[model samples]
Target: MTYKGNSIFKGKFFVWLALIILAVVPLFSGLYWQGILVLVCYYAYAAIAWNFICGYAGTMSLGHSVYMGIGGYISTIILETKGVSPWIGMIVGAAVAMCLGVIISYPTFRLKGPYFTLSSIAIVELLGTFISNTESLGPVPIKGGSGWSLSQTGNQAVMFEFSSKLSYFYIAFALMVIGLFVTYRMSESKLGYYLVAIRSDDDAAKSLGINVTKYKLIAMAISCFMISIAGTFYAQYFRYIGPDRIFSYDLSVQVALIALIGGQGTVMGPIIGAIILVPLSEMLSAKFAGQMSGLNLFLYGVVMMLVVYFMPHGFGEHVVSILQKAEEKIFGRIKRKAKD
Candidate 1:
């Protein structure tokens, strides 16, 4: 087969192998590890979403968590109050997130680089304040200085709760699969080419007759929608939601970090990044979080700085390069042996 044909076959085989391994993981791993894997899948989805905008379109957003928070809250509220199933709630949440993405993109897409990023930060902060202060919708009902419950009470499953970590693990795994498929498809399509063009040179893209605003908005909408689906999975898995946890700046930063460390813009970069960092950070937090508090986070930051300084293209790209080189060496040796 030609090199391109062989590459395609290898890609398909790898994807199939990954799916098979994921299918069997729950049967062997313990509950604690299962829960950790679930978190990994969730972060993997979030990283892919972030990559669509930041890595592909070259638009860095510091407040992407706003969509995740919105999606979680919307789905939770709908499922709890309206007796809607979480499956349906996921769609509704994603739609709402897409609308918000469009709204934000309209004004901010005109700005360049850091200015756009700053706008995202400002918008998230503004929304966080608004949500926290709004008495009717706030997570807590305030009585003077104290506060009461903000979430509805009911059976856990109806509200997307489960007693077993296994349930959450499967849900998260499925979500990661969906997110990966969407990203892969987008990266191979015409829209993906347009996004690359815009990322490389916006003015040149526009001069070439590409609709810059339209494509950017499309990318943002798709990115938000996918991330919102992740949010729905999060609410269902955790069975609780709060502005501080869901809408925090740290969540957005984590998303960007995973993408950057994995090889942003490449199909497998975000997934590789998430797989590497999430587990490492989780393990560190589990071991040292109680004793040292912020130590794990500090270490994470240091590791990120090192990765940025050394392997700026990310581990995925590096891995691919190494594999290609090894293949060339093996093929050359085979040719020499044949001559002998």
Candidate 2:
């Protein structure tokens, strides 16, 4: 097969297979388990989205929850008052998030390393505080510090409201698949290479005449749009939105954690991280529901420290390396046996 054909067979087929399994497996899962699957997809999607800018472009945003909160508020407010379908709200929310991304990129993109990270955190705190203090934007009353909630839209698929968790599961799964596909495609494209070059050394990339700022902004825009979509989905699924919940520092940490723990900069890292961490977090939450609340956080710290100490490159990279070695060893044995 040609290189293109080989790539398609190797990458696209597995993505489809994974999506199919996600879709089918939930049908057999109990209610609680199905919820976990949906949560995994949600966090995984956000992590992948964040990784586009942080991992590939090396922007290292620590305040991505800004976009998530904006998307949620935009979609929920429109759905609640205007009675518009969330299908449309998703697009609008994403557009707004993209604009904020572009706006922030101008100033934040100029800073690098910890400076950039601090700027991002500042933006999130500023936005959160502003939203909480503002009571009204023109005629529409802002939810402000109280947060907002969405009323039932009669389980209409067009409205993005569903009576069944299965429907939400499918939507979340599809979003996850889409995030993976986009990440994979971008990773193989020229833009992806440019992002990598910039990340490795912006001075060298600029010396080569590459527009580093432009590509980083592009990455930021795409990442913002993607995570914003997830935010809209979260609002629609849970039927509520709170600045604290959506715009919290914890949310931003979770997004970063998912990608970092699994293997940042790789397509499968965030997915792997989400698959393991989300479920474990949930289980810990369940176990400590009425008792020890901080134990899970402590355990997560320990796990993260161990991964950093042992597998500094991230778990996804380590796993991939191991699999390749095992495959090579098995193939070598097969060839030797045939020769004998």
Candidate 3:
């Protein structure tokens, strides 16, 4: 993660390169392949958003699926009942999610390490149960355990529904881009500095007059707000969402796993992680799901375990090292040729 080089090349070139390649991918991708890439972008966006709190701020949350569920439910319900757009739900859900994030962080920020992670899982389960069991929350229909589906608006751009998978892929890809930009910005801000300090040692940061709770709350706010928007995107793309899936602990784990496996807290880590994991999982599912339902998950666990043992910093650290070496060699050769 610390492969220093030319400021501009290290800062921006690889990021834009990754993005540009992804942008061009769909032009040659088929419908089925496009769907797989869509999921990759979706998970990548989730991982990046999760990185804000758990990665940089060093507060582990294994329950971010709660935010995703809240977002999907809000947009789906509004679109179903009021005939409004998911776009509006994205905005409103973000506000609600931010408030909820603050509420959760205010009390639990005192807890650190595994304790905070456990509390978040508990909170997610509590909320997930309530939404799944209850038929209605005030006026909006929860529809109980059966969940709800997004109303079809007939390939409408304003409604966020499209006929082709290409649109969804682009939308998901754009969301990832936005998440990357925000993370990049946050990493350079004063708030980012404070979070880094707190992550290193909260007490030491407190001694330095940093408001530890305030900054953590701010990070959670941004994290929840951004992730909720992704929820809307998921709902629109999938056209169906339920407590069992949206609010599932498994979803949170997937997001966290991707972020961590990618080298959490780094700019391109989650993207790299998604590029590695998503397709592998899909292939596993397609090849093994019939003979052994849980085989893919078992293999996934094995991969994660291996990663923990070998690359504790995830793939990003090594990837950056190699990239820097390659950059040096390439530019070094150019300079030599120019001198010749």
Candidate 4:
């Protein structure tokens, strides 16, 4: 048993080593690839946030993009129009997202399974529509619209604009590191055990003296706050924000898919998922965007289906299991030889 545990620890050490190497790739990669890596970091953060709720709390949400969209729009507006620092704007955005999460949690904590999922989707659509029609907030124009303008030139600290992608990459990488650290702590703490119990069976968990609602709400707040940080990152990096782009259903789906593919309920699942999927998705979109629209999305769908069918627990869990089995075999042989 000790040997098995040591082997598992060694495997995790190597995983962290690999992550550290990938985190520094931007220092040497070209501008274009650096931009992609920045995006990978952003998605990784978002996926980790989603995993907190869906993977750990077992409350799947299809409307998490609502929080992301709100965060992005609010932060961008404050930074661009009101001349606020993006760093401060991020706090405001995260607060708003947390409030929204609280508001939704009150009514939806009673729901489970498909109903909760449907309600989440409805909330996102509702927020999207509201943002689109309410133009009184200083013209939050959609991209490519008649009144849309992408022009921005102002104070460096307030606007969060930079001449180089490297800055954005580093900022995103830092956030990803923070996200992973938080997740690792959460997965090993008492809250994590409660979340697992809640996910396994809410009724059983409730009977065990766990305050299901309280824990769920806490998870929702943490998840939304984390996702909002990613939203701030997005606004700063892209220098743009709109309902369709920031709060799109596609973004929400991407978050969920990343967590699901990597290993739901595991600390490193979302990061693994983002690292594997984001680059692949980027490559496919770049190659097929103009020639075959929708092809890349179709491929994503197929890939998702394959992962669900073959590895429902996700790649991270699969890797962990394999390492455990190998360790067991090695240690078993050693024990037999010692006895002989």
- Compare the candidates by lDDT and give the number of the best one: 3
Badly placed stretches (over 4 Å) of model 2 are: 1-19, 322-340
RMSD in order of candidates: 4.3, 3.7, 2.0, 4.2
The weakest ten consecutive residues by lDDT in model 4 span 1-10
What C-alpha lDDT do the candidate models reach, one value each? Answer: 0.77, 0.84, 0.85, 0.79
Ranking by lDDT: 3, 2, 4, 1
Model 4 C-alpha RMSD to native: 4.2
lDDT (10s digit) by residue, model 4, range 1-340: 1222113354675567767887778888898799789888899899989998888988889889998877777777776677778788899999999998999878987888989998998888887777766765556433321112335664364457777888777788888888877877777778888998999999999999999999999989999999998888787777767777667778798789888888788777888788888888888889877887777567667778989999877877666666668766878689788999
Model 1 lDDT tens row, 1-340: 2122113234554556656787678779998788778888899889888888778888989889999977876777776567788788888999999999999889999999999999999988887666666555455332221212235454476556567888777778877888777877887789988998999999999999999999999999999998988888877776666677677787888888888787778777777777778778788889885797776567657867988898876777666566557666877689788999
Worst 10 residues of 3 by lDDT: 2-11
lDDT of 3 by residue, 41-144 (tens): 99999999999888887888999989988888888888888888888989998889889989988999999899999999998899888888999878768898
**Candidate 3 lDDT score relative to the true structure:** 0.85
Choose 1 or 2, whichever is better by lDDT.
2
Candidate 1: stretches off by over 4 Å = 1-12, 137-159, 322-340
TM-score for candidate 1: 0.87
Q: lDDT of candidate 4 vs native? A: 0.79
After superposition, the stretches of candidate 4 with alpha carbons farther than 4 Å from their true spots are 1-10, 137-151, 154-158, 320-340
Model 2 lDDT, full chain set: 0.84
